[model samples]
Target: MSLFSRRKLSEYEPNDHQYQLNKLNFKVTKLEDRIDNLENDWECASQGESFQLANGIDAKEAANRVEKAAQKALPNELKKAFDEINSAVKNEQQSIRLWQYKLGIVNGEPQWVRIYHIAALSRELKKYGYETKLDSNDSDGRFSSLKVSWEGKETSDISKIDPAKKYILPLEDTECEITDSVTGKAISHEVAYACPRDDKWEIIYERKIYSDAVVVPGKNIISAPNWVKSIEPIEAD
Candidate 1:
């Protein structure tokens, strides 16, 4: 006979502690398998083999393509504006001497006009007897309001304000028309200054009287093939 009789199969059973231990061992084995799989994946990725996102795209390559697309989507005008600003900074131009502000977006494009440029425009406008007001908060670097008035008529529309148009070319001999202040009639006068004012020349006649300095919208006085040229960036102290 055996030294100890073998227990019947129905009578054999695992204790509570043994049962819990078996469950814990099974979970640990599963966790170790997952860690091994992660390490293998990292090794494959480092070797540039079988390392693509679920969408069949390499993560780094996808990021680079997205960045390029974003850069290409920038408008040409915006790009040119940035280049001009960068060149000004590199050359230490006076236009960028003072703090600059991006007033706002116009026609879905950003306005890169600086404070110096606005001040120059204001001075020129004042020379023509136009009242210019710059209502801006420098703290935020954006114009809170801008107003331009001529003869009691005011316009706050930025679309109507053209920096290039405000430029007064030195063509005193040019012939153009001017409106009489009292008679409200068009009078011919020698153009003291030719301004590019929205598809025409805003003519300033030789002032014979105090009120004669008014600007009159007239036909193109410049007939030279290269009459229109790029405006130089304003430089002022």
Candidate 2:
């Protein structure tokens, strides 16, 4: 018989078993409702926890990626800036060097070794305020070697300096002498040397004195125009 089948209502006694069965069914329904509620709450809590954890993880990963990229790019960028600064400094130093070379402020003597004769030695001397001891138009009237001196306020002793090394001028011709054979006029030119040995004046080099041609300015040194006419080959007098 089906559990729902009904018997003759009056004849069936309403026993304690029937009453207990009704109470048990009611309690089971309430328990099932409570379980459903508990399950819903658990699911909600789990979903919330999952969302928070995932969000935190994703956020952390993104931040780490950004930091890595920044780290990788920083050194190269800094290096590029440093290279630019270095290049700028090099260019500035080059410009200063050019200026110093042009001004003739470079250390040491000029390289006149290759040249057999220094063309504008007299002109350079005049520019530095050293007066030419000899001046002549005729090649024969020129001084073989002119003595130059500094009449300026700041004069140095000449003996302390080496004469052989001072302003060395090469000889174009050994037989050069400054004399006006036709006019019978000869020039005895003397050059001044800024004495480093003593504050006294001394004639270190002298020439029989002859003029061949006027000295021209060289490439590396400043030359005074009209000051230096020509260089003559001089011998030790």
- By lDDT, the best candidate is 1
Off by over 4 Å in 1: 1-15, 35-48, 52-63, 76-237
Per-residue CA lDDT of model 1 for 1-237, tens digit only, reads: 443544543244556667899999999999999999899999998988876447687678888775544333322222233344346535654232222355567799887654333443344434433466766666554544334344342211222324434323333123445679999898754434334445543334444331323332222222311111212211111
- What is the alpha-carbon lDDT for the whole of candidate 2? 0.35
Q: Which stretches of candidate 2 lie over 4 Å from their true place?
A: 1-48, 52-57, 91-237
TM-score per model over all chains: 0.25, 0.18
**Residue 3's lDDT in candidate 1:** 34
**lDDT score of residue 182 within candidate 2:** 82
Model 2, position 30, has a per-residue lDDT of 100
TM-score winner among the candidates?
A: 1
Work out how many backbone clashes candidate 1 has: 0
- Model 1 / residue 117 / CA error / Å: 23
| Model 1 steric clash pairs | none
lDDT of 2 by residue, 128-216 (tens): 33454433334532223333443342211222223343232232222223467688666554332111123321223234342222121
